[model samples]
Target: MTSLLKQPVVDAINGQVVEEFTASLQYTAIALYFDSETLPQLSGFFHLQAQEEHMHAMKLLNYITEAGGQPIVPATKPVKNHFESVEEAVALALNQELKVTEQINSLVSVAVRENDYLTQQFLQWFVTEQLEEVSSMSDLLNIVRRAGKDLFRIEDWLVQNPHEAAAGGAA
Candidate 1:
């Protein structure tokens, strides 16, 4: 079938796919760091986060394929494997999510420019997802701040508030 997605839109979505995968890899690195530090609970949280990111990428990949566009995989820079603390790691996550949000918005703007209603509609889901991701990451970082060198307290809080913590392993 002829592709409903324009080449530029396909390129943009493929870029998102790369960004999502990069996030997954970064989360994996963070999880490994947490595990090595003997913070199994935190590690598990990041592991779940990594899986979610991978899922996000796969969603985009499938969407592009379904639209009959050729999906391109881009090369990514190395993910940072070392973080001084949980706060640092969570902060990095927030920053990355924010960046991804920006990219998604840009794609929406492009769809608007091209008058591609279907692509614009498709991107709305990503807009909402990014909002949730940003909100969750910020909340987790805030919890870390409140815990303030008492990571175990954060862990306990996550246990008490499993839904809030479950996004990236806050639970």
Candidate 2:
């Protein structure tokens, strides 16, 4: 099939794939940190996040192939395995989400610039997803800050609010 995506759009999507895969690895590292700290809820939450990020990368890869563009499976960037505190770890996650949001916006811009209506439409899901991602990460960061020394409070909160906990890991 002829490629429906412009070269620039394909390139941007490939870059996003790298970001998503890196996020998956970072979340895995965070999960491991939580596990080493004996925090089951936090570990579980981050593990789930890692899976979600992996799925996100796969989604982008599938989209690229379905759009008749060549998909590049790139190596992930390095992830920080050690964190001093839960707040610091959550802050790192929040920062990453913010960066990913910007990248997704840039991808949409590229699709628009290239006049790739299909790609633009396809990227809409990611655009909307960023809102939830940022909001969830922001809420989690706030909870982590408020919890402070009471780390178990986060675990308890996660147990109480399963849905919110799944995404943001807190209410």
Candidate 3:
């Protein structure tokens, strides 16, 4: 039976699942690093982020199965386990968010080019999600830079700003 999703699109989405899982692993590693550094709040934040990324990967896997395509699970790269500072870790996160945004944009472009309205509509959510991801990371990086080596300031900011703790920052 023919599937609603194109082969290339399914491949792309499967690739995206791997990317999301990779992000999860990266966050987990960062969280572990924060825990080792005695930054409980940051560690917890990244742990939550890792869970969100894992959820996103499962969501994509579901989409593939629902669309009658086989999801290709790929091995992710090893995550960097050390950071010089919270600022550096946050910078790495921002960079990853930017890359994910680029990837989502490319997927949207492909969906449009292929006239795959269903995929296009589905990817719209990701487009907005990416915007929020980028914005939140930018905000975090700015705060990290302002805090300098005072990691407590970041924890304090988190304590004071509960809204910033919103997972994935849905904007």
Candidate 4:
């Protein structure tokens, strides 16, 4: 059998796995912060976000193993749990998703430069995922921004919004 560790594609895959783990931690911290702030709906969204990130990590792990690459244990940093308002949380999410999208794009570029077709193909899913992630976060931010200072209106909007929860579950 070939050693996968020597391959750049394997390194990229490991990096993605680490990124997903970091995302999970970040989302969990966000969820806890929202929960403490008495925003259960927002907390639920972040909880689902955490779950989805965990799933993404597992998917990368499985893909690495299937590709004959040894899975590298990831060291994740603790996520901070402080936000001024609902808009702040949404902005954080948007920023995080954008960062993740850039990371994924970098990985894709690496694969392309290395002429690793398989790795590039695998990254296609991440490209699509980033699109959805950014869009969802943007939508939430827009709604919160439009809701203005009305906490009750924002809470009601969240209560009525269930698509993200369902979509996150599916992801």
Q: What is the TM-score of candidate 3? A: 0.94
Candidate 4 lDDT at 22 equals 90
Sort every candidate by TM-score, greatest first: 2, 3, 1, 4
Cα lDDT tens digits, model 1, 11-86, are 8889889889999999999989989988777787788889988888888889889999998767865899989999
lDDT of 4: 0.82
lDDT of 3 by residue, 1-171 (tens): 458899888988988887899999999998999899998888888888888888888888887788888887789967888898888899999999999999888888878888889989888888888777788778878988999888899988877776766747433
Model 1 shows how many backbone clashes? Answer: 3
lDDT of 2 by residue, 29-86 (tens): 9999999999998888889889888988999999999989999999999999889999
Q: Any runs in candidate 3 off by more than 4 Å, and if so which?
A: 169-171
Give the C-alpha miss distance for residue 111 in model 4, angstroms. Answer: 1.3
In angstroms, how far off is 59's CA in candidate 1? 0.7
Q: Give each model a TM-score.
A: 0.93, 0.95, 0.94, 0.91
In model 1, pairs of residues that clash are 45-169, 165-170, 165-171
lDDT of 3 at 170: 37
TM-score-superior candidate, 2 or 4 = 2
Clashes of 4: 0
Relative to the true structure, candidate 4 has a C-alpha RMSD (angstroms) of 1.7
lDDT of model 2, residue 129: 76
